[model samples]
Target: MSEIQTVPESRRFLSALGPGLAGALSVTLIHEGARRVLSHPPRMDVLGKRSLKKGLRWFGVRPSHGRRLHRQALVGDIISNSLFYALVALGRPRRPYLRGVLLGTLAGVGAVLLPPFLGLGRSPRRAKRSTALLTVAWYLLGGLSAARATRTV
Candidate 1:
């Protein structure tokens, strides 16, 4: 009789790490792009205000005046997508569009849930929404980066 071998869950989880890291890198790139787009002084101020309002609305809470919740959202976005990618890499089934959507949803939910639970600042709805948006954005960015890198080689 022949013996069969099975892959361990930890090994599968480790395999997923690269994709998760890739997702984070993609997000960082998009964030840099957004920042560049809003760099001009007048545009910067306008975007700042809009981002804060959006972040507040996203989490179903009011933002402190002059607070940069948008930036925090960007951070949360990276964290959430990275986690999803890591999960997927860990031998989880892939669903392409659905995966991105699920990741975004989780990111939004976590953003709203974590802060208050940890005795930090109030959960910002706008930031949650922004995190969700960033997840989708990172997915697109990751695909594009992969495609471009493949072409260059």
Candidate 2:
């Protein structure tokens, strides 16, 4: 009985991964699209690279120049989304889709406010108005996608 249960549980965990990947990719696509239209500042890839570079610096490890920064950024972004929905999968939301919207809004707002508190960089309030709004929209969409993905599973 336990072996049978373990198989489905493992499968469920694997299934949850797709939604997370979708969510992350969706956010990236939307962000780029919005940037093209609205001219928002700070490419997410650059921000990811900066964050990763700073992290590596802390450990006395230096990253290579220019090349693979985008790849590194992509991997980091995907991992963050994966980890986030992994929690949702385990938490077993009664209404995953609805929960996703709520979570996304909270997360979007948190993202805007967190930089100063976390000391990552300047808050979006200092950024261009379009940039601030687009950033929040992308984050919200990511959450929606993640939730929708899981629901399909």
Candidate 3:
């Protein structure tokens, strides 16, 4: 008789990490690279930076400025995005691309709409139309990357 073998929970989680990190990296790269060329770039990292600063202030910790702030914000963004994308491991959806689109849309909408409600101020939706669109588009790109990685990796 053959005994059944099950994968450990931690191993399952680790399996998702590679695809998740790939997606997060893609999103960051697309946004940062675009910032140099766009006259009115969507400032998602700025939003993250501001949120981080507020969190630090709440804890009475002094936040860094300029380049340091940017680095911290980018790190935070990547880590958070990685975890978010890693949720795919739980579902193991048959259609990963669709899952990617749905997940990305949800995140993009939240990014555009949640800021004002959270006292984070105006969202990308309040900015120029292009900014709003690009904000969503980059997220979609990340989702696609993650979904593709899920299939291949």
Best by lDDT: 3
State every prediction's TM-score relative to the real structure: 0.46, 0.79, 0.92
Best-to-worst TM-score order: 3, 2, 1
lDDT of each: 0.50, 0.70, 0.85
Backbone collisions counted per model: 10, 0, 0
- Tell me how far the alpha carbon of residue 41 in candidate 2 is from the true structure, in angstroms, after superposition: 4.4
Q: Cα miss at 149, model 2 (Å)?
A: 1.3
Task: Count clashing pairs, candidate 3.
Answer: 0
TM-score of 2: 0.79
Q: Give per-residue CA lDDT, model 3, range 16-88, as digits (tens).
A: 8877888899989988998898999888888989999988999999999999999999999999999887765
lDDT of 2: 0.70
- The Cα error of candidate 1 at residue 66, in Å, is 18
Error of 1 at 125 (Å): 3.9
Mark the regions of model 1 whose C-alpha exceeds 4 Å error after superposition.
39-84, 92-97, 112-153
lDDT, candidate 2, at 110: 70
> Over all chains combined, what TM-score does candidate 3 have?
0.92
Better of 1 and 2 by TM-score: 2
Give candidate 2 misplaced runs (Cα > 4 Å): 1-11
* Model 1: worst 10 consecutive residues (lDDT sum): 39-48
lDDT of 2 by residue, 69-132 (tens): 7678778877886766554444565777766677667666776677667656776646877666
